[model samples]
Target: MKKLSVIIVNYNVCHFLEQALTSLAKAAKHVDVEVFVVDNNSVDGSVEMVNEKFPWVKLIANKHNQGFSKANNQAIRESNAEYILLLNPDTVVEEDTLSKCCQFMDEHPDAGGLGVKMLDGKGKFLPESKRGLPSPWVAFYKIFGFAKLFPKSRKFGRYHLGFLSPDEINPIDVLSGAYMMLRSSVLDKIGLLDEDYFMYGEDIDLSYRILKSGHKNYYYPETRIIHYKGESTKRTSINYVFIFYKAMIIFAQKHFSTKNAGIFAVLINTAIYLRAGMALMTGFVQQTWLFFTDAFVMYAGMYVLVNFWERHIKSDSDFYPPEYLHYIVPVYVLVWGLTVFMYGGYKPLAKFYHILAGIVIGTFVIAAFSNFFDAYRFSKGIIVFGGMLSILALLLVRAVVQFIQHGNVKIGDGRKKRVAIIGSYEESKRIDELLKDTHYKLNVLGYITSNKNDVTQKGYLGYLEELEKLVQLYRLDEIIFCSKDVPAHRIIEWMTRVDNRAVDFKIVPDESNFIIGSNSSNKRGDFYSLNIELNILS
Candidate 1:
């Protein structure tokens, strides 16, 4: 029998799944590790990717979107290995991670399952590397924001066990499903992950059951993986809030006493509404802040224009009625705001001409919209003068905002990214050629390597040892590593050593067209490649 069986449940994240499989194939060379890609009906051609690039992997293509737990269980039932590992598709395990996990589990018979110290895409430590079981009080602290208020407080921040050191190997209450390793024997006794959970709480439920079965879960920090997700779920969505809290309630009712379960349910339900309200508020604020800001600025400009026109053009301090400010001017601003929005004025990198066109269309719309209402009608001359003033006001607002944000009043400079590659001459040339056909406007700053023969090649900045300094000197925006030439550990080390947040790191698998990386822990994984049968490239 194999020493370990690795199971990954993939949804529509095809590129991420491919990266994970490539890393796993490398990591499994010394160990008897069998990998299973349980694709949950991904229409993004994820199954085809595994079949084409990684024929050694056992593929389980589901007919529909099976939840994370059931899909993992499907693989678990088929594997005959001593250890079973449930891994996420959007992760890259270091070369030694798999071997280290097997060695640790073999040495610690009391450990039912173990999780590694996880880093985000940018090499920051993920707090979920070790988690405390979410009891009612723990859930309360996390749900109401007390955990964030006192992240290190033992009493309040027990949700993540902030008091425990992430580097130390301590017994932990829960294991993250992203990199959970379990002994096959213990799973046989305690049973598979509860299918009651579609996504969120299965890890906690299994951790609790394992403890109840008298085995321990551990935090192994000797090796780490890039989870890329910081987390996979969109926790800010109301649907996620409801589903996650609902899973918590399920755990409570399944494990707690009837009375305790009732209390836990109440707390979770209350938290659901609170979190949902916050989600709505956050979404509203994020989506409309620019709209509201521009609308207010637009209205203020109209107000100033009306005053100027009344005093100078009409020769009357109060030439227009109260409807001019309350009704007519507001209607005018409203039409302009809608039209400007429709013209893509709110988008980043929208040109000055874009806003000008929007204003023109808006003025025409106001003229037509007012003609049907006699109280708001005016001569074409007056309307044209007001329209001209609106154009100046709107352009000034856009320019000032752009200048403050980008430090340039150029409005929309669509700057090309400064990028570099680390690989052999042939691989670098292949990558450069592929990027030419794509929309990524990048100035490839040449390749970086320690090989002396390629030192004289075009775009050779310097040796790999001088990468950080080279990035600083050249103001490099991104670095792409060809996995065929650079090891995963080296890639991770350089990613950590390079402290420039302005610089992003991407990896192009050997001979693979897609370039994958996540800019930060808070951001989702990114992909750049030709648009194929896959649903989306980014």
Candidate 2:
């Protein structure tokens, strides 16, 4: 029997899998390891790649995607190693990752399972590298954002055990399945990961069982690996929300005492349904806020202006008749609103120019209608005044909303976002031009590159190694990667490194294209779209 058996469940991530296997090869140099690649019906030639590149690996090509727990169990049943590791394919281990884990397990006979300090792609330590059990109270803290608000406090942050430093070794209640190193002895006693869990909860279930069976689950931070998480399911998807929350519910029902189980089930169900409702509502609001904002502002401003004109300027003629208010105002508002919507008014972050163009076009259409119709001819001046007033009204409304939501109106006024570019000279230059062309709300500080060409290095702040310092010196709010120059792995690595720096990271993959008249713009600036981290607590 080998000293360690590394089991990897892979699906469609050939590039990432190759890198992981390459790292595993390096890590296996000092240890007697048997590697198993369980390809879950991947059609990306993953099986062929494994066969050709890593012939030593035991390949289990599933006819269907049997999911995480079941697939890993298949490999576990076949392996006879003293120690078993369930490693995700989207991770790259350091050379000593296996050796160090093996050494730690060898010395600690009581450790049933162990997890190392996991880093994100950009080198930021993942909190799940070590976590407290997701008990009801802990889950509450996580669901309500108490964990984030009071990360260092044990009371509020028990979910990820944010009270503990990533580098500190501790006994944890649950280890992330992304990298769980378990003893064969413990597996023999506790059996395999519960297949009842399709994907998400098996890790927690297994960890809880280990503890119940009287084995300490140690979190050793001596070794580190980069996990490019969310390859299987994006955290933002409805599927993720349902499955992740369901997993928690399943765990609670399976383990909680009978007395507490009923209450736990109620709480978990309420949390899940409430979350789903909130997500639906949020999506609806995001899609319609612009329309509501534009319509309300335009109509309100037009009402005030038209009434002012009626009372003072055109007191005798009744040019802005109350009857016209019924027909004319709604039509006017609708035309303008529809035009704005057509020009991307529904986008989360709308371009000011789009609003202006929509208003102008709508006003012209109204004026043309007035010229043709005798009834509307008298109200042309009022319509023009109202249209002009609407521009100011729209700006004011957006500014107010921005101030209320983000505590600042600079983002609304297009004066915010201190940005830095990461790419070769030409790529960075192209991105800079794109940002400028799109009239994005960004302040490009400079470029960060390792290329020695004087053209690319002309405006270079520093090499990628000096990212932290550069960000500090320039007070960068976002970093946009030139996807042609930076690989996905490097982008993720950069994100992890600066995860806590109060900065947003974006990527403009490949070439650039523009759709000026789209119903809604999907981008924030020149880079990829911005992600909204829904605060479940609020």
Please give the lDDT score at residue 316 for candidate 2.
58
Give the per-residue lDDT of model 1 (tens digit) for 1-538.
Answer: 9999999999888888888898898999978999999989988788888898889999999999889899999999999899999999989888999999999999999999999989877667889989998888898898889999999899999999998998899999999989999999999999999999998899999999999999999999998888878234554568788888899999999999899888889999999999889889988998778777777877787778778877888889878887778877777777777877899888867787777788899888877877798866755655676667767777787778777765667777645678999988889888988887776667897889868778788768888998989998999988989988998888888887898878878889877888888776755677787544232212
Q: Number of the top candidate by lDDT?
A: 1
Off by over 4 Å in 2: 12-15, 42-58, 121-124, 140-156, 311-313, 316-331, 343-467, 472-538
Q: After superposition, how far is residue 275 of candidate 2 from its true place, in Å?
A: 1.7
TM-score of 1: 0.94
Residue 382 deviation, candidate 1, in Å?
A: 4.1
Worst lDDT run of 10 residues, candidate 2, spans 515-524
Candidate 1 clashes: the total is: 0
Full-model lDDT for every candidate: 0.85, 0.76
Candidate 2 backbone clash number: 4
Q: The CA-based lDDT of model 2 is what?
A: 0.76
